[model samples]
Target: MEIHGPGGISGPDRPELKPTEAQRPDKAASTDKVADEVNISEQAQLLEKLSQVPAVRMEKVEEIKRLIEAGEYETSERIEGAARKLLEEL
Candidate 1:
């Protein structure tokens, strides 16, 4: 079957039958390929480093626990200061 285009220009009279590589212009390689490259941003590296740190400091936790056991952990001023700081963070 003949395929018609603009201005009545006809396509190939017959489809290719075992056309060689050089005879087939449409078969030419048109795209270029390169090796994939990946880059890590500075922020990502910093986040990764931060993730490696422990969420809670065991030494500080133990010290606070000891103070509570000694009946020295509940000063009103200290509690007010902590509450203020927490509100400020929010």
Candidate 2:
């Protein structure tokens, strides 16, 4: 058993292939790039929401730091609750 390819290289008959106009390099190279249309309404809304957010909160950071320094951050009960929730998820 044998397999015949596109040019019938393995068969008795061999057909000649002709290239079309569209397949020519000169015709292909002449094509132009098209610009895509975009909707800016959603993007503008997202930008407005992002701009409303504060860049930083030094007060919150200082409070958290103070809590840690006073040995009050992350109680054992909170740690156990978080671990139980994680175990439930798994």
Candidate 3:
């Protein structure tokens, strides 16, 4: 019917609660004042730029799909051109 614990609600035996150095408001405020920084790699920056770029032409994509379906997308001339371009890049 009565509550009794280590400190007995309020007495000298009751352990005082205080914030640690890390938990103190002043210490926490100083840590919050530090400026956060972020570094983006060149590749990531390029990717972000690419994301903002307009999407590929749907008409051109549809045309290529139609040609592929008709078995006419990979002709000899196109193959030769692709080979030439690959060699040029290399």
Candidate 4:
């Protein structure tokens, strides 16, 4: 029993088969790498902006501190007010 492939691709004459590295990457590995980069850049930019706006978080901090100092902090009231205002603005 002898085998002969067309165009001279006979037994032992063909090159050894090799898997290519350019094939589709491992989906989970690629997604994790991209997600890591995105998280790093997002946190970096957020910190930079927060640093530049010295008064941004300060205003919020002052409001909270004042409430805490005066014992006027009401969680439900603030939440409701903020939710209502947000809805109105939207």
**lDDT (C-alpha, whole model) for all candidates:** 0.85, 0.81, 0.84, 0.76
Ranking by TM-score: 1, 3, 2, 4
RMSD of each: 12.4, 16.4, 7.7, 15.3
lDDT computed for candidate 1: 0.85
Pairs that collide, model 3: none
Q: How does candidate 4 fare on TM-score?
A: 0.26
**Order of quality (lDDT):** 1, 3, 2, 4
Show the lowest summed lDDT stretch of 10 residues, model 1: 7-16
Model 4 RMSD in Å is 15.3
Model 4 alpha-carbon miss at residue 31, Å:
52
- Indicate whether candidate 2 or candidate 4 has the larger lDDT: 2
lDDT for 49 in candidate 1 is 98
lDDT of 3 by residue, 18-89 (tens): 988777667334444567899999999999999998789888999999999999999999999999999999
RMSD in angstroms between candidate 3 and the native structure over all alpha carbons: 7.7
TM-score of each: 0.49, 0.39, 0.42, 0.26
Better of 3 and 4 by lDDT: 3
Which sections of candidate 3 miss by over 4 Å? 1-48
